[model samples]
Target: MKRHAVPAGAMLAFFLTLTGWPQCASAATPDGAALSALWGLPFAGVLLSIAVFPLIAPAFWHHHFGKVAAAWALAFLVPFAFFFGANVAFGTLVHALLEEYVPFIVLLTALYTVAGGICVRGNLQGTPRLNTGILALGTLIASIMGTTGAAMLLIRPLLRANGNRQHVVHVVVFFIFLVANAGGSLSPLGDPPLFLGFLQGVSFFWTTVHLALPMLFVCVVLLGGFYALDSYYFYRREEARSRFVESTPDSASFGIDGTVNFVLLAAVIALVLMSGLWKPGVEFDVFGTHVALQNVVRDVALIAVTLLSLVLTPRAARAGNDFNWAPIEEVAKLFAGIFVTIAPVIVILRAGEGGAFAGIVHLVNTPSGEPHDAMYFWATGLLSSFLDNAPTYLVFFNLAGGEAQKLMTTGATTLAAISAGAVFMGANSYIGNAPNFMVKAIAESRGVRMPSFFAYLGWSSAVLLPLFVVTGWLFF
Candidate 1:
C-alpha cells in the first residue's frame, strides 16, 4: 500500500521548538540525582509503555505500536551503554554538577513548533527555477526554514511547476535527502542535534562555520545528479503526454497566503529564544506543583500560540490550499503509537554510562579507529531514523562525555558529531523521524507520490551517504 507523506520540516520544527526550553537557573554543579532522574524517566517510560501495550492489546501484535514499541525501547535504552561506559567518570560529575537535560528537550520542541506554524500556513505558486537550481537553493532554504518548513514551503511549488511532467517521485525522493536532513545541520533551530550541542557548549556560530561545507556538498550532489535524473523523467513524461492531446492543465493562480502565519511563526520562535535565554535563580510552585517559570511560561505560550493560529487562520485560506488537520493528526497518531510503546526500552538504555557499547562501533567509527562521535552519530542515526529522534538524541548526548581516561581527549567533539548525525540523519528514513511522514501525507493530498519506508532509505543510502561521509570529515 502507498503510505502517507507528512511535512518532515513541520514536525521537526515543532518538536525542536518544544524541546528548546531555556535554562532559567544559574550554572550550578550537576549532581547525579538530577541526571539520574532525567535518565530514569525515559527508561521507566519505555518500560511502562511496553508493558502496557501487549497488556492493553495483545490482539494488536501486528500494528505499529507493538513492533515500534520494541524497537523504540531498544533505541531508547542504547543511551545507557554510554552512561555505563562513562559510569566511572560520571560517578564523580553526576554527584557534583547540576545536570540539566530539560534545556535540550525544550529547545527541540521550540524549533519544531516554529517550523510547523510557518510551514503549515499555506501553499506557494510555481517558480521558474530549473531542476538544478531548485535542488540547490531549495535545500539551502530547507536548513534555515527547516526541512519541514522548506519542504512545506517548496514542495507544492515544485510539484505544480512540474505538474506537466510524470515520474516525479524520484525528484521528491532526492529532495527528501537534501532538503529534509542534510540542509538542517547548522543551528539548533535548523536541526535538533545542533540544538543539543548549543546547550552543551558548541557555539551556534561555530556550528554554521563547521557545517556549511558539508551542507553545500550534499546540495550539489543531489542537485547535480538528481537534475539529470529529473530531466530524463521530464522528457519521458513529456513524450508520454505528447502521444495524447498535449493539453496544459490548470495551475494555481499564484495563490499565496499566510503572511500573519509567518509572523505567528516568528512569535513562537521568539518565545523559544526567550525560554532559552530567560532563567531565574528562583524556583516555584504553581497551585501545588513545583515548576520553573521558564518552563511554565514557554510551554504555555507555545500552546496558546498554536491554538490561536488555528482559530485565527481563515478557513478559506486553509481550504484554498487544501489544508486540513489530518496531516498533524496523522503525525500525532503514528508518533503517539511510537511513544507509548518505546517507554520501557528507553528506560533500560538511559541508565548506563558512556562507552558501554563503544565496542560495537569499531567499523566506520571514528576517522582512524580513534573513539569518534561520528561513529555514534551514524549508529544512533540508523536506529533513530526508525525510532524516535528524542531518546536517540539523548542517549548520544549523554554518551559524549565522562568516559575513561583512555577515551577522554576529543570525546566532547565526538559527542557533538554524533549529536548532529543522529538528529540530522534520523530524518533520513520515513519511520526514523516524525516529520518525514508529515511530508508524505501532505504530498499525497496534493496528488504527489511519496515512497515507501524502504524505498525512501534507498535514496538516502545512495544519495545522502556520500555527502554525510564528507560531513563527518568536514564537521566532526
Candidate 2:
C-alpha cells in the first residue's frame, strides 16, 4: 500500500498538470461585458469543423476529430490564458468541467450504458404503423427515463427493424424531432433545461402543466408528418423492393431481455431526482468553483451504476443489441470541445444587457419592459438551436427576472414559451442536443445514411419552423 502511494501521487500530479489545474486560489472568469464578439471565433470554428469535415474529409474526421476538437479548444484556451492569465483560464476550465461537463457526460454515459444492456429481443419489421408506434412510445417515455435513456434504449431496435430500407434518413430525423427533443418538454427529468429551471426553484410539475399543450401540439404534428412520409416511402419501396431474407428467426417473439437494467435505469432516475431534491448544504471548492455535495454523490453513484450495469447485464442481451461504445465515445469527445468552446459564449450571455449579445437579451422584452412570450420562445429557441440548451435556458431564465414564482404565475406564458423553445428546438440540429448526435451516430453505425449537418438543418427548417410559428401565434 505504501509503495503504491508514491506512484498514485505522481499520476495525480501528472493529471493536474495535464489539465492545467489552477495553482492559485483566485478563480476569476472573463468579463463578458468587456469581451468583443471576436472571442467567439473559436466556437464558430468548432461548429464549422463539425459541419464541414464530414463532407469534405470523412476519413480525416473519423480519425482525427478528437484532435480537431482539441485544437479548437486550445485555440480558445491559449489566447484566453495568455490574455486573462492562467489563473482565470484554469478557473473557468475547472468550473466548466466540474460543474457542467463532467456531470453531463457522466449522466449521458450512464444512460447509454444501462440502456445498452436492455435489448428488445425478437423478430421485428419496420412498417409505417410499427415505426410510428415506436416513435410515439419512445416520446411518451422520454419524459420518464430522459431523452438520452429512451433514445439509447429504443434506437437500436428501430434501426434493426428498418435495416432493409434504403431511404430511412427521414425516420431518424423524425426520431430526433420527436423522441430526442420534443418529447422531453413535459418534465424536468426529461431534459436538461427544464431541470435547470427546477434547480432555480421552478416547481417540478410546472413544465408538465404548462408545456403539455405545446408538447402535444409539436409531437402530434411531427408524428403525423412522419407517418405520412414513411408510408409514402414504404409503398414506393414495395413497388421495387428487394426480396430480402428476414434476419431474425420466425420462432422468436417480441420481448425484452436484460430485465435487471430496467431496475438500474430506475436507480439512475432516482439518483438524479435525489440530487435535485436532497439538499445537504455541503460543498467543495475546486479552484474557487463551488461543487455541491449532493451533485458529487449523484455523479459518483451514477458511475457505480454504469459499472454495475456492465457487470450484471446478460452477455447475450448486449451482443444481440450490437451495443458498442462508439456512439457514446463520439458524443463524449465532441461535446467536450463544445462545452469548453461555448464557455465564453455562456459568460457573455450571462452578462445580459451589457454583454456582446445585448441585442439578443433585449429581444425577449417589449418596449415597455414586459416579457414578450413570442420573442421569448423564438429567442431562447434559436439560441438553443446553436447552443447548449441547459445554459441557454438559464440565460433566458435569468433574463426574464430569474424569479420562479413570478415566472410560474404572472409570467407563466413567458416561462412556458421559454421551456417549449429550449426543449423542442433542440431538434433543429445534430449538435443542438446530446441525444441528437448520439442518435445520429448510432443510426449511421447501423448503416442508416443520416443527413449531413446542413441537410438536417434543412429538414428541421422545412418541418419544424412553420409549426413553431403556428405554436407561437396560437399559444405564446
Candidate 3:
C-alpha cells in the first residue's frame, strides 16, 4: 500500500481513536497470571512474518505486508475475544491504540516530518574519514535531537555522499549502530525508553549522568571499528572512488536548506519535554483507557508542528532530500500490529513470578533477593531486541522497584543497566527500534543493497553481542 492509503491496521487505529468500539461500559485489564503461553503465539507469528516474509517472498511482502500484519493481529484478537469476552478484547485494543501506538507514531511522524524537511545542500565524498565524521556527528546530535531526528536528517546526506561507492552496506549498518541505537543512550530525548523513564519520575539527567561512560565506551569502539572496515572497502573499490573524485568538484560549497525546520525541531523537543515536565493531573477517558491531558496536548501540537513543517518547507528542499512518507508509513502499520499482539506478552512479563515467563523474570533477581545487574542488563537487552524497547524498559524498571528515587540512588547501577540494555541492544534487529527499519528503507530506496533479516542478525550477533558482553562485565 502507498503512503496515502491507510492500511487495515492503521484504519482500525484511527477508527478507535475517533470513536471507540467498546462492547461494554467498563472492562478490567487482562490478568497475565491467568493467561497461557499460547496467548503469545500471535505476537511471535507477527515477528516471524516480519523476519521471514521479505526474505522468502519479497514481491508479495512488498505489496501486501500491511494485510499480513493485520492478519496476525486478528489472529490474536479473534481468539481473545471469543474466549475472554468482547468487552475485554475491546478494552485491550483501546488501551494499546490510545496509550501506546498513537503516541508512538505521532512522535515519530513529527520527527520524520520535521527532519525530512531540512536538506543538506551539498554532498561530500564518503571516504572512511568523511563517513566516520558523519557517523560521529550523528552520534553526538542523536542525544540532542533524538535518534530518529538525527537519523532522518543525516541518512539522506550520508547516502548521497556514498552514491558512487560499490561497498556501502557496512556504512549504513554502522549508521544504524551509532545513530539509531547506541548514540541515544545518554538522554530521555534520545530514545523512547529513556523518555518513558522521564515520565515515570526518573530524573531527566539520570541517564546522562549514569550512562555517559558506557555510551562513550561503546561509541568509541564502534567508531574505530567502522573506520577500519570502511578503509578496507574504500581501498578495495578504488576505481569507483577515482571516477567520483574526477567528476565532483573540490569546491562544491556545502550549505543547508529548510533551516526553519531546525526551529521546528526544537519545538518538537520542547513538546516532548513539556509533556514530561508539565503535569496538570487531568485526563480524558477513551473507552477504558485514561488519556492524560498533557499527552493529548503534546500529540495535538505535534501534529500541528508536522503540518507547519510541510507548509513552510520549500518543495525543492524535500525533492532534493528525496523525502517521502513510505518509511514512516511502514513503521506506523507494522508497529500497530506489534503493539496489539504484544499486549499479552507485556502483561505476562509484568506478572513477574506468577506469569508464564517467570523463569526469565527471575533471572534478574539473586538468591539473596537483590537485583542482579548483569542479568538485568542481558535480559532487558535481549527482550528489547524484539519487543518495543520503551515498554520493555518499563517492565525491568518496575521489576527492580518502580520508584524513581530508589532506582536513581540505591539501585543506580541496576537502573543504568536497564537503561543501557533498552537503548543499546535495539540495534539487534530492524524491528528493534523504529529508525532501524526507516534507515534500511531509505538506504534500499537509494540502492544500498542492505542485508536481509537473518543476515543482519548475523552482523549484530557477531559484532554487537561481544561488545555488549564486555560492556556488561566492565560497567554492570
Candidate 4:
C-alpha cells in the first residue's frame, strides 16, 4: 500500500523542529501550579473534535483531520509560547516528542507492520461459539503480544469469519472492549500504561498477580454477554446463516501464514523489556529532554524488526489480510496532536492540590487523608477514557506516592485500582487507547459500519460501566 504523504511529512517536520531547536539556559518547564484549568480547553477541544466531527461532517473530518489536530496543538502551543516564553514552550514540545510521542508511535508502527503480514487462512463461520473462541484467544495473547499486536493480528481473520453475517458490528465492538482493552490488563507488556508502570519501577509480574481476578471477572462477563447477543443475532439471520454454511468447505482448515512474524513479535517484546532492564547509564539530551541509550537501542531494534518483517513476509500474506497503512497513519497524526495538547493537562494534574484541578485531587483522598481505592479506580478510569491512559496512569501513580516498593506492599490496593482503571476504561472511547482507533479504522475500511464516536461511548457506558462498578464494589 502507498504511504500517506501528509502525516509522514508532518511527523518528520515535528521531529526535526523538536531536536534541532536550541535549549534555554534555564530549564523552565510549564509550571502546573501557575496554570489555570482554562489552559486545558485546547486539549478538550481536540478531543471533542475527535468525538463530534466524524458524525456531523464525515468528508471534512476524513480529509482534514491532520489539520484539525495540528490546529488544536497550535492552539495550546501558541498561547503557551506567549505566556511561558518560547524557550519553555519549545522545551515542553521537545519533551513531549522525545519522551512520549516518538516511542509510542514507533512501537505502534512496528506492531501494526509486523502483525499485518501474518494472515489466517480458511473459511470459518461466525457462530457464537467460534466468535467467542477467537475473542478468548485474542484476550489470552494480548498481554504477551500487546493489545495493538494482538488486535492487528486477529481482527482481519475475525472479520473474515463473520463476513457473511448480517449483524457483525457488535462482534467488532466487543473485540475492542475485550481483546483491545481489558485483555491487556494482566502484564506490563499487555498495555502501554502498565509498561509505563514497569519503567517506573513496578515489577514485571506485579500486575499479573494483582489484577488477574478483576481482569478475569470482566473478561468472563464480556464473553458471556457476547455469546448470548451473537447467538440471538445468529438465530434471527436465518437466511444469512444458511448462506454462510453453504459457502463453507468441509475440507477447509485453519492455518497461519507468515508464522515467522511471531518471532519478530517476540523480538519486539524483548526490546521493550530490555529498555526497561538494560539501562547503560548513558543519555543524550534533545533540547531539554533526556533520551536514554537503552531506549534508543530499543527504538532502533524495533524499527529493524519492522523492516525484517516487511522483507521476509510474502506479499500474498499481507494481501490476503487486506493490509494498508491508513490505520497506523491515522494514529500517528492524531496522537501527535494529542501528545502535544495533553502536555498542559498532565502538568496541571501533576500539580496536585496546588493546581487548578485541586478538587479532583481531593476526591481521590479520604477524610482521613488516605488514598480512596474506589475513587482512584473511577478517577483514573474517567481521565483515561479521554486522555491517553499511560500518562493518566503515571499521574495517579505519582499522586498515590510514587514509591514502587511501598505501592507493591502497603499501597497495593491503590496501585491495582490505578492499573485496572487505566487499562480497562480505555475501551470507553475510540481514542482512549491507540489500538481502539486502529481496530475501528480497519473494521470500517472493510465495511463493518462502525459506530460513530459518541455512539461508541454509549455502548461502553451501558456495557462496561456496570462491570466496572461491580469490580469496584467487589475488589477495590
Question: Model 3, residue 69: displacement in angstroms?
Answer: 1.9
lDDT by residue for model 2 (157-190), tens: 8888877766788889999999988998877778
Error of 3 at 32 (Å): 1.9
What are the clash counts of all predictions, listed in order? 85, 0, 0, 0
lDDT of 1 by residue, 1-476 (tens): 23233332344334544665112111122233224334444434543443355446645732555355445544533564345432322222221111223343333343344344332222232222354566677567654655555665565556655565556677677666666666776655565555544444454455566556655665676677876776565555456434422222553343445556677667755765675567663444211123446645766776776666666666655554555555444444444334433333333333332322433434434546455566666777775665556556655554443232312234545655565666567657765554565567667666776766566678878776777777776666
> Across residues 199-291, which tens digit of lDDT does each residue of candidate 3 receive?
668877788899999999999999999999999888865654455562234565788989999999999888987887787777666556777
Model 2's number of clashes is 0
Please state the error at residue 77 of candidate 1 in Å. Answer: 14
Per-model TM values vs. the true structure: 0.66, 0.89, 0.90, 0.90
What lDDT is reached at residue 456 by model 4?
90
Comparing candidate 2 with candidate 4, which one achieves the higher lDDT? Answer: 4
lDDT of 2: 0.82
Candidate 4, residues 1-476, lDDT tens digits: the string is 23222222244445555776333433467678999999889888887887788879989999899999999999999998888777688778888887878887788788888889899888787888999999999999999988998999899889888876778899999999999999999887788889778766798889999999999999999999999998888886655545656233445587889989989988998888788777667766555577777877988999999999999999889998888887788878888888788788778877878888888778999877799999999999998898768767877887887778899999999999999999999999987888998899889888899988888989999999999999999999
Question: Can you give the lDDT of residue 385 in candidate 1?
Answer: 68
